[model samples]
Target: MSEAFVKGCEGLPWWRGAVIYQVYPRSFRDSNGDGIGDLAGITEKMEHIASLGCDGLWVSPFFTSPMADFGYDVADYRGVDPIFGDLGDFDAMVARAHDLGLKVIIDQVYSHTSIEHAWFEESRQSRDNAKADWYVWADPKPDGSPPNNWQSVFGGPSWTWDARRGQYYLHNFLKEQPDLNVHHPEVQEALLQVARFWLDRGVDGFRLDALNFAMHDRALTDNPPVAEPKQRTRSFDFQHHYHNQSQPELIGFIERIAEVMNGYGARFTLAEVGGEQAAREMKEFTHGQDRLNSAYGFDYLYADKLTPQLVREAIASWPGEEGEGWPSWAFSNHDAPRFASRWWGEEERPRAVKTALALLMCLKGNAILYQGEELGLPQAEVAYEDLQDPEAIANWPLTLGRDGARTPMTWTDSACAGFGSTDSWLPIAGPHRAMHVAAQEADAESILHWTRKVIALRNAHEALRCGEVEVIDEGGDLLAFERRHAGHRIACYFNLTAAPLALPEVSGSVLLATGDVAPDQRELAAFSALIVETQ
Candidate 1:
């Protein structure tokens, strides 16, 4: 078995500097050979995750969903999707993860649910049913347009005219995912029950998905338009999303969730927030004594370029101070494009991958390492015919599409890359076999090995885990910072570009270094990252 999972400093919480590997359930593995991944598959792969030296695993939603929004449209909170596995399989997976000393954190999309949900079904039946007000419903305008100018993140108006209720319903995402009316006391109580259900199931924590969208203004006010960019992607991009989301009442509900989590021992909760005001809302959602443990903003997720300034700005936001919530960072995840493809050129990717891994570990907040990242996998080339993601399909050429990042994992050089025997849901990446786990294990110098080494180093050093990050330099291609905690300090330097350069006088013992650099050498190779033990 892998080394027992170690967390943070004694007084600090376990999640403070934890490195959690995100496993997109469908793309991780397939045990039944049904061309789809399941809980059994995740169970079989727990060792692979633990072996990576991550403290825990964050499994994407496998709840009963119609696959309309690819499991984000959860239909039943208590049941596992048949395609993924049953409750028995889920229990076994959680047990195995604990045995390997890896905590299991699952996705909870509390903001919305599948339109087919029992709550929505009964609520849409009439205006005064037992659960009629559980969902956001309203009357259409006199002209028969939506009730307001709110827009869906997917496309079109946020309000959908439902014939059943004879009123418009709110859905910030796809119509299949109707927004939950958190204003109702009953809805809040039921969601708390859902949280309690998962905590009792041996799971260690939760990643609340699109949490900022949980509540909206009851006034049905029209969102004002924003100007500037000539080209817009979707209707949601046309206006500032002030009215439809990020309400003041949201904080109380978050505190309520934290209250539920406190009943379970050492349980962690993180909010996933995005969009224009994410930075401000993240602070609001996670701040204070009773809110969530931490939160992540989309600072690096949609970044057009990887500059030293971008890295500096993102890390500078989360200062470890009184009343400020802890920060979490995700360079890559299920929804966003792979960082390697987004930030580096082909020839530079090999070195850049290792440097980025070290950089992520050096950051102060908890990190979410996407699955297949250790293998240095790029965005898969998906043919138009094999497209599965609805967002990609709707926009086509306009968007880079999330489908490219959701492909199957490559485990071998065999016919199907070990994900399954038959054709998988999304095709395996063309170049993925070269960096498969089997091949990486055979090569000690592989990025996979480097990733394991860096994660181990981060865990061993207290400064890297529970320290305050002080930016030392942010100029040109070079970025440097020092992490300090309880008199222990580590200085991290990185050459994030393809151009080789000479380094300044290096002091302290070299903890971990990538590229051609002897102990006495001062020159840094292209895309080199080195961590030095500073006095």
Candidate 2:
């Protein structure tokens, strides 16, 4: 490694060019034999996470919740749910993770709270209550209709009639998750208190869930109809989503959150932004030094196909520079189908898995790896009866419920796929068992091993970390780009097609390869990928 490369990384911000491995707490690993993975389970698996050479772990919500939205509907921002463990377990986990040199970033769902949350419950009781304005409660129209035409992402109208308050409260998701009225000064203070609570507990950072939805137009203007055709199956796609989310006022609130984080020292905040204007909103959220550190959208996570054109477009969407915010990329997460099954047919799953990992790691900006991704686990096939996600159930066969992605991580090939002593909360059958962590760990050339090496290789070079990405050429099934930082540059390539292709002439040293390259300049095998450092 060049000294300039080492110097570039040493001075880089903790998250600027870091790799964060995402852990969906419910599916990572179960340690209490309770069928569900908990904080304790994650704490026990710190070694595996640290071994990946990732800079940090972005754990999904484990806060006290009603489980209506799984952990997303938080009941207590300051406490852990009994199902996941208590405050003591959380503190211990943080301590252990820090010891392993891993920054711990927990989820902060500030946009809404479970109906069971005290703040929401109190706010819903009466219009005259002290917390009446804590939530987005508005009087109904003269005909007892909703105040606006906004719709929820989950499926129905955004406003729900509250008998006790004689008004309708806004809910961007399930009714159980009522949107918080961040416009209220007290509400902002309360949310800041929630952040301070975690900061005091020594958390390294936070992954702000649905950040764009945190603030809405106080005038409650109706969202305009989408002028363009919708290609996605999401309910929110039907409208323009103008007033309901991605409000301009959200930037000020994000700055306030960043101010609070800055007081805590090197704390990072990443927003999960998505909607019609995701790219613009993401850049806005992270535009200044005083706002969110970074933001990730649905660009890759929700993509149904992995093509060179799509990859180029997604990366080019966000131009990282002096003033613009950084972008974080993820191919799969708890909310989307596994990329392996989404991108490749069942027959070519293995090659697709290896190629996907290499492609993700080589991409500029922070990379997030979901649980079980390293093990090359394909999406679990959950029957309709077993489906737990409300969106999936509502959309049925058209959308595979998120439960397919939430299946317990197969640790061993034993009963329950070593997820637990009893049957896991979600079944662990099919291709998951053969691709368990234990099974793959024993194979030196497995995807899991390659992921580790890819991460290590990326870490060793500054060009692949926080460099500017320039698309050299994206034609046919081959995708090529160069990541440059200062004078150092590295070219990364991926062959998304099934048949082999001739290697294009390039001036670079082979740093890593997901497959063997033939001397005869034959076509690249199905789904092959490589990273080369330019001379």
Candidate 3:
């Protein structure tokens, strides 16, 4: 959880420093033995989330889609995909969640829609159609090539030739997921209506997907070339991506969205901002209360390793200033390889994960815990033949691909890891089965139980929830800080390396401890963490 959701922080908004759980629908659970998770499955599991002490659950798109980009390409913004369930199931799921005191935040892919969407179908048929300019369209250059040199994040050129319209359309991702011309007033209104549709249906808020790419520079100018490219796999990584995304025009639309959300009671907004200018855009999109409630960057998601320097830099980005929008942090999500695999070797994984969670919960921003994170699930190994993510397939072995992170969540030691009666949409990692919910639930010392305890601890402390952070020590492999709220102060110390270190002598009552620590409180084992209440 971030620094905005303390249990006893009177008069403060519930979402200020709330902890949200992200559930990738297809891999979360399968109820009807269809090898895929559905709304019913998520509803059945709401109790687990509520028990975990999360403020809410953020469900990735379940809207009608063609499975291109796996639900990011929306065909119908209002309709739930049949594979997931119908609208009735969605309403029921919302009801169950509310019943369990959990807020529901659904993903909104306003930047683009599937090529099969009604608006796109009409717009692509001819330039004279009612929705002709609904999407970003341009003519070929005099040489009959693309109008600009912008590249798609998924690979190849961002523009695709359209025979019917005789123009090239922009797509920052899969060609099937056409970018929307958000600059158009009509397009912005249409998206707001989509938000209204969901808000009326009782969703607590939204997690805007790839929000920074929603608008592009209208001049169709070429993206500048990178001066120094590093270990590039796709052409997209070689460009500076200036004109292609993170346009200033985006802030206006974000304000418009925030206006609509303001009309609703306590509705929250979170943007997933990624790019070379992510830090800048994150601040821009969420500058004030009138804009997005908060935004999360890719600092931790794509990091090759977790270091004291990394934590220091990330926390420094947002100081929780008076008018500055709050921040959210995630160690693992559906898109990147799990942090357990990225940050530590097999021998240190268990203790490292525990300390990581303590660090995450103790941080100043909202914390987003992805499904299976509580169980210390690492990235699964999905063979090439079983791969499903488009970006991963395009880059092949060069990229780890997102499929490994999107594999089925382990529920039990039974066949299919008790995820479903049939084979899951993706195979379960063999090792994950041993760490399933059932096994961990029975073991009092398991990561799953520890996750609950850490979350509860955060909820019980006002200082940890929405406190101001002071970095006391970020030297070498040790990171120590204090979270201050009102008159209370809590000190958090972490040994990030794989070797024991002398503990920092701080006068305070012991609040929590993870990993091996000498009884005398003089030393901390590798990957250990200690939390102290100094006031």
Candidate 4:
């Protein structure tokens, strides 16, 4: 039994302070040599996930799709796309994960469905069909233009014209993804059935994608503009997004979702909520009884720098209270640039890697560690011709998009980098290959080892897992905090800068230390993180 398990969470669940590794299925592993990763491929590589010591794995969407928005635009909720494999393959993968002691959380896209989905196809046929009102259909304004001034996240207006219905249908993302009429009771029942299908298939939980966008304001209203410090790269960034998403009706759907999952025992539910109103939305979506178990924000995902203030604000947002919900933290994921490249310059990345890993482990909430983070993989350079992500293609020279960070995982130093024998879907260049898992597994000083140590430390201490967090200092280069669980006090400190920091007077037995830390003389080198026990 883990020392961290010495005392069970007073009233909390296993996922309260767990670590979940995200697997972007398309680039994880390719078993068929089809240049695309599949469910069978993931099954073949389950050992790597288990070795990470993460409590579970969160796999991205693999539902039948038209490749629009990749798998995010689901064509069918119950079927696995042929490219990823069949339902049998999914069942086998889930069984394999359970055998390896890892919980499986699949992605569920509730906000919208691909234009090719049977529901959408039927919804667009005619206004009088059984499924005609299944999607958000609206009549154009007086000038026969879009219903409102809302913009799609990819580009252009959020409403698409349909000749059959002779009305515009809402699409908050790509035009290929038509927004579902979530307010329809029939739609809610259909979604509940989808959850039941997955739970019966043996999934332990779900990672709801763009959950806030699941419902939209019924009245066709225009969205207001916003003032921002950063230049607006896309049209979606120009507006406040009030009428288009984060509707209050979404909470009721979450309650229904909880009901469906709760019927299946201890199933996990995590919401990927993002927007200008994320702070309030997260609490509303997760707080109190019968809501989502947890929700994550885009705070650290888009952060240009890893400042103490940033960490403090994120932690302070989710204080464990009577009715407050739990928070989930993620530094990197499939949708944004890798944290290493964003936070540290190329020359100083190695030191920053160790410190960042340490910092994430010491946090209070559940940590979502994206695939390949353990190897300290920085964002790979994806040339324009090599980019696969639709977002990058849509916003070309204006933004790097997410293709750079979504490059295929590097597993070896060979030509195919041990991913497969043929050319992969996305490029796996020399830089990524240099930090391959094989090389890191052999090097004691590798970022891989450091990651394992940090995860191990978290598993060995309840104080670091589900403890009550209190910020001691968050100024300059130092970010210090104390975590207390069952009267056991632990102090965690980190230097998130390139210069030395004077160590404060600390009375504790050192549990873990990385970088330059001289306790006797009271000094810590650049990018140092030290953990200790007291009382």
Q: Which candidate is the best by lDDT?
A: 3
Write down the RMSD of all candidates, one decimal each: 1.8, 2.1, 1.8, 1.4
Ranking 2 against 3 by lDDT, winner: 3
> Which residue pairs does candidate 3 place in steric collision?
1-367, 2-365, 2-366, 2-367, 3-465, 3-466, 4-16, 4-17, 5-17
Q: Against the correct fold, how does model 4 do in TM-score?
A: 0.98
Model 1, stretches more than 4 Å misplaced?
Answer: 1-8, 518-520
- Model 2 bad stretches (over 4 Å): 1-6, 227-235, 518-523
Can you give the lDDT of residue 380 in candidate 2?
Answer: 87
lDDT of 1 at 33: 91
Which runs in model 3 stand beyond 4 Å of their true positions?
1-7, 515-520
Task: Give residue 118's lDDT in candidate 1 (0 to 100).
Answer: 95
- Positional deviation of residue 281's Cα in model 3 after best superposition, in angstroms: 1.0
List, residue by residue over 1-535, the lDDT tens digit for candidate 2. Answer: 2345447776666787788999998888888899899999999988999988888999899999989989999999998999889999999999999988899999999999999999988888877889989999888999999999998988779999999889999999999999999878899999999999999999999999999899889999998877675545765667888888887877778889999999999888999998778888888899978899889868888777988999889888876667888889998899999988888888898878888888888888889999888988788899888888888898888774488999988888788887778877777758788888887889998888988988888888778887889998846668888898878888887888887766677656778877665323435666888777784
**Candidate lDDT values, in order:** 0.87, 0.85, 0.90, 0.88
Shift in Å, residue 335, candidate 4: 0.6
State each candidate's clash count: 0, 4, 9, 0
Name the lDDT value of residue 467 in candidate 4: 88
Q: Itemize residue pairs with steric clashes in candidate 2.
A: 500-523, 500-524, 501-523, 501-524
Error of 2 at 15 (Å): 1.2
